[model samples]
Target: MDSSSVCHAEHVPSCHAEQKRSIHTGWRADVWTASSLFLAKISLRPRIEVALSTLACMRVPVAFLLVLALPICKSFYCYISETLSTACMPVVVFVAPLCNAAALASLEALAKQPDISLGVISHFPQEQLPLHIRLRLAAHWQTASALNTAELLYAAEKMHTYFGKIDVLLSTNEHVQEALALIREKFGIAGMRPDVAHNFRDKARMKQRFFEHQIPCARFQRLTSRQAAYDFVEQVGFPIILKPLCGAGSVSTFFVDSYAQLEPALAQLNPSEWNVALAEEFISGAEHSLETVMHHGRAVWQSVSRYLPNALDVMQNAWIQWRIIVPNAAEQVAYSDIRHAGQAALSCLGLETGISHLEWFRRPDARFAISEVGARPPGAQILTLHSRAFDCNLYEEWIRLMVYDQFSVPTQRYACGVAFLRAQGYGVIKHITGLDEVMRECSALITDVQPPKLHATPTGTYEGDGFIIVRHEETAKVEQALEYIINTVRVTLG
Candidate 1:
């Protein structure tokens, strides 16, 4: 067996024995032993006293027999108490910086679940967490650096001294998924393993897996040298995409249209043996994202959304405000092809239980090509859009699926969309225009609004300064409202 293969308690006895063997010994082990002893002393004191009193009142032969039976009874008590302790409330550790908006949202959902024993591993101190979440936590371990694997493992170990075995260790941060997977392997937590996580984090490896499975995706190459980049372009021609082997969002991603554009992008990338980069033949067409929930290695539910002009275009043109639309009928018969392909791609990539955000393109020929997948929830208020569309709390839905292996399929009741508000030029915002007109025109359709602030620096991403979420039973109505907001409401910076 591979040393890194995950071993679960519910598996064969040998698997449980393997986990037992992997536990650290010496001082840390002593602390765990002491904790268990303390718990036992507090819980079994009354039972021990009752047993001693009964034994004292008995005759000599009966007393000897009772004494002989006492050891067996004590062992039974320990077994029952241990089982109850483990089965009562599941221990879940969420690892991420507390300052992230997405993390805070997820933390709130997890804390609201009364049956979970939640612990947190973060770079920020425990006090930074909201009072409600802090009160619900079983323990919180702050590391000097959350991304450092050594520090993360130490935090989990220290948490184990009080919580025993961690049922699940997770982080929504893409940068921390691989590190958390390694920690899960080290502790035998049943979740995504390192190899599966690597397939999600490394775009090069993910594209290779897609190829092996005959999954329809863009042509890609792992570039290790400048010559390799040149050779790939020679074979595939111009208009290629370049990005780090592992990255998130549109940061550091470059679109090269010609030879003149390639050198500057390469200089910024500095691709070499150690600093590997990925290049792909850019597929020009409509782009969309598919959100899927997997349970025991298969997708159970899915939702799809369309980008107004795609992420690259929004990044390239700073003046363009980004918008996303989640059609009410995303799971209908029309999207059957992409739905099947997306699920198959996830299975091939070995994602077990969690929500995944997958980006894909619809080519000019009307064929869908998978771009990349993240082994976490979709960011940029996409899930919030889903919740509005379904009229259910998707945040709690994610928590239930990840923590309890349960999913309640939500009914899609409305078509939802979000229009981002981005300023036209550089510098802090000085003036805003056309807001009163939008509210007057689409007040009935507008469900939530976050107007941009004055004198605040632009966020510089596709998700700009603020956003407005709108939903309606009719998809066209939602689409029309989004268009009106993007065109009418404008942010001006001087």
Candidate 2:
């Protein structure tokens, strides 16, 4: 039969129609009842709305059928192939950082089923994907830097297969704004606007909004020229920090301690490339991060992490080490304060549902000041640490929030922390000593260690040499063991 004829045949009001049209008067009533039940079963769910919408805009019936078949096929395969819940869960497309080994592993672990798809938009090539995998099986991957009209169209086409509609579209890089806009327009996906993404990506704009909102933050001046930077330094005085407005991973971030050092630092910054830089008043004291999950513009799940040596100090001194301590709800007063500020900041920025990573500095006097906020998860395996420590998978929690509007609340069975190893100097790896002794000493708390690779470069700004993640119900014991590990372990380089 032709495609239209098949469509009409399947969509018939009842099997009685076929019986009346044909000479088969002896057809059983049970057959008609079963057919009606099957149609009703498929039509009642929300996914059908998605499937029908996907089909409405397409002209090719075959392509539409293939597209509609993905989710159904996935559900069937998962039901038979794996030991997971058959209940329908909303699918989410997670766009994550490229070459992030820790994040990828954590995400894969959290997605109990294949409901969460990964998309990387960076230097990675699409052809590198495994041949056995369907392109739709792969998270609609693309490069943010090279995204164009064609790529967006291609993504829309590819996404049309598995998903009739996308519940959420999460992205990081500012360059992918056009692509995200295309996805929203084509697929009716709901998410942050391209402008909101841009604002979050651009440090200057984000800081300005925080300032207008009367939020507490370090004083910052945006500079475009050497003279402009000089004037700002003159006004802000010495001991300020300089960083690229659009940079990540703490690259090109420098601290100016004296007036004489300003010119050399300014010369290192490219006016055409680094176009703008921020000269901010340095806040001293311990540093911490707040991981928040917002839904419909409200902060629902929040966790605070206290950084051991502070991020700036860890970046400045190569040998200095740091650890992240995730405290239980009852013990985290400082974190509670940070969460309050973070919610306010999200509201001011008009951020709705999604994950937000916010960094802040806690003063000795107990006041907290906002540093920065990213629209994605915290970097350097924070998600892993949170997951293992709490026994709750944060990546999966993020997916659930995005797709199903549900948040995973940790039972707070234990506190977790990770100590990042820092090299004594810049060089190739000679040897890593004392790991066995360190592990023995912190055996109760130490859970895992990432050994340094051979010929590894010394850890510096934005580079994570490696780290040891530890967990325990007793926060004091966890902290003590972490401190001992940091002190006893030695990383010698050639």
Candidate 3:
């Protein structure tokens, strides 16, 4: 045997002896580990006392043992408490300013949830938010000079500086879903990816996917020039829908029915206003929109609403009173194809966990054709109407969807409808002619009503001035109440 292999204590070197002693000491932590570890928790005082009591119960020698472990328990306690303090609180960033009713309501709803905080990164200032709503914003909000991608990223970095780092990004604004998606990808955060958002934000691309999937969607053409518009007219004929490729609502949308009306509608398209415009063969049908909350690339809940006069008609005629009703009934046999096509459309878009506001057509033959899908919450007070109709806090649901990646709320309970008050002509609001009459006739059925404000600016965006919401178990009653509210109320602009 060599000297290195010797096991005799007398023959062992000083360094080897100390190594052997350390091994013995490490192995001897038997009782200390069992009692001290069990009791040495974040609750130091009580844990130490209980651990000491446990050792006493075990009948171990304990006088110096408790004293030795007191400091160790203090260190472990600090570690655990520190971790618990910072680990649970998540940081959220909102893309849009909390100035509008929708943004404000969503913020308030998010505040009520546990273990989350929000920091705003937007083009608007904090003062833009109403005082009450501004008070709820987390840490603080940092405004970017522009809503462009570069400035947005810088503002987000500023937000990160203030709130630690972004854990969730709430993409609530229209026409900027692509920007939000890019930011999410660059930062390697949890949110809508760029590819998925492209399919939503880009209309031509979206329609192309729908067509390829054998999903029933109206044929569309991207308008590059006057020649392209004319070519589309000659090829697809008149009665086509002309709208901004990436716009929401009906801001600059035009419905060209006759051959003579095509150029005037094309004249509405300004290269400065929009980079691209699309003209599609308009499907003649009853226009309705479906609101879906998706999770893990699957739709978890869906709500269908019928658009009064359709959005195209609403845009064409300013006097049209727009109302969307969410019927209480689920699984309508007529809408089966619509639902199936909507699902296929969304799957192609790769909506993993977000809300989709899809508008489709039910033709005279009852066939379905998707008009468009917006990868955002439904605007025009539809969310609030859904809340009243279904008896679920949809604003709360928005927060839960964006922050928690969850859609556990019930989306349908009662049939709900909203009649929007829009200006018949361009001017400031002078007066709202009917309220008492609406209440007298539909008081029991009315859930919410905000009369138009005086001197308010009006642009044709579907949601103009104010709206009245009503709900009931009966869908026909809800429709009747909407008809009453629209016919009864008149917004005067001078």
Candidate 4:
């Protein structure tokens, strides 16, 4: 791919054909590589004058001049913004994991907005990201971790003079939503108010809000003391699930099959880690997630997906594996009940605009009960599948919602699914078996694949060590291929 195509592939803005001609593909490298370097060391008057003269002498289009001379323009823009205070661009504070190449590419769609200055607040440093992604970020501030909101806020404050005012706070990962909301309030910025943040962050409070709206969900109790948990179990019976009042990724979540099971789980939990604990009556049913994109208090796009064996079970039992299926035809029709519940949950949350990852269950009687909702995009390559299935860049559209308050592309053209491969036994990964069989059998149906590395230790997430995404026009075909993959692929550790 050419430089312009590479830009679009990274979700960056592309130069027009006329602009491309000015650079003249073969001639660009040697000239601009030298020009951009010399462009940086020069000063204001001489910089623009020489840049214009060089471009005019070469008959380069002005837009191509901006592309080749991006560094010059950037330094110039910063000079004006910092010195003359003449910059009118809105400054947006973005927080998300920066390690993944795909995530970085998607995020670049926002960071490279020409008229806007993006202040990236991340747990990972620029060194952690690829050079292509690192170069795109206008300003970067690293934190000790995602929880270090104070560090992020202070950095933003220090950058205000240089970048004007931080207008909006945004995060693609749900873990940072509450922090983003708090930061927005602290800085007098706009978007996703702190008051509205609770409906997603605090799962116990979220269930209460949903229940208040007459939305069907499992019975839950917010508990502080051990006695309260026991009392909840007495009333609601055994087989309860205990989790942090505010948590993500089913981390530290416990499943209690009986009083015997409850005691050991209770003894292991340290209440100090989480401010509050949640004990809820566990419901037996199939699990599904309602993916919705909201704009101005209304859902403009929605999709339904089912999980294999459920996340909680997958976490509890090391042997259990899982996959997510974005349903086709009849499954989508059957998921209409969940779609209704998810819409109601968002309406009750009262969030003006954002993405919702709402996990709900369908009981044996066909009753739909909400599990939890996160005010962010679903993880585990769900967005990747959504993009392939819909023939749109879901990540780019998601960033648009965070930056522009709307989803530019709005249609689904296919169905998609992902099967996560994990080690059945725990230890350092020693070998992977049945890979060639699965890949060769499923190659045509698979869009992406990453086999587990030979010696890396396993990450104890639902995603496991590696995963393969399969997509097709028919959801049934996708489902069939996923089942085939999960059954055949094996990661063995010793």
Candidates in order: C-alpha RMSD to true structure: 9.1, 13.8, 15.3, 9.7
- Residue ranges of candidate 3 with Cα displaced over 4 Å: 1-87, 142-146, 270-274, 330-333, 409-411, 424-427
The C-alpha lDDT values of all candidates are 0.83, 0.65, 0.73, 0.73
TM-score of model 3 relative to the true fold?
Answer: 0.79
Q: Which pairs, if any, clash in model 1?
A: none
Model 3 global lDDT (CA atoms, 0 to 1): 0.73
* Model 4 regions lying over 4 Å from their true place: 1-86, 97-105, 111-115, 271-274
Query: Between prediction 1 and prediction 4, which has the larger lDDT?
Result: 1
- Backbone collisions counted per model: 0, 0, 0, 0
Candidate 4 local lDDT, 1-494, one digit each (tens): 23221121123222343222111111222333355568577776976688789879999888886687789779768754553432465667677644553456556677456555565666554456565555455555545565666655655565554355787677766666777788788778877877789778888888899888999988998877777788998898888999888888788899997888887777666443345688888989998888898888888888888888888988887766678988764557777777777888898987778887888888998888889888877777887777777777777787777776667755677788998988867679998888899889888888888789988998767788899998887988998999888888889988
Candidate 1, residues 237-296: lDDT per residue as tens digits? Answer: 988999999998877999998989999999999999999999999998999999999988
Q: Extract clashing residue pairs from model 3.
A: none
Q: In candidate 2, what are the lDDT values of residues 1-494, reduced to their tens digit? A: 21111112112222333321211111112233355468677756687777677777775587768887899889757644432331133445544335355435534543454554433333343333333222222233333333464645554454445344455565443345446756666677777766776677777788899999988899888887777777877787878888888666566788888878777777777443348777788888788888888989888778788887777777777777778888754676546667788999888876798888888988888888998887777776677777776787777777667666788677666778888876666578778887889878777776778866768876554345778988887778778878887888777788
| Candidate with the greatest lDDT versus the true structure | 1
Comparison by lDDT, 1 against 2, better one: 1
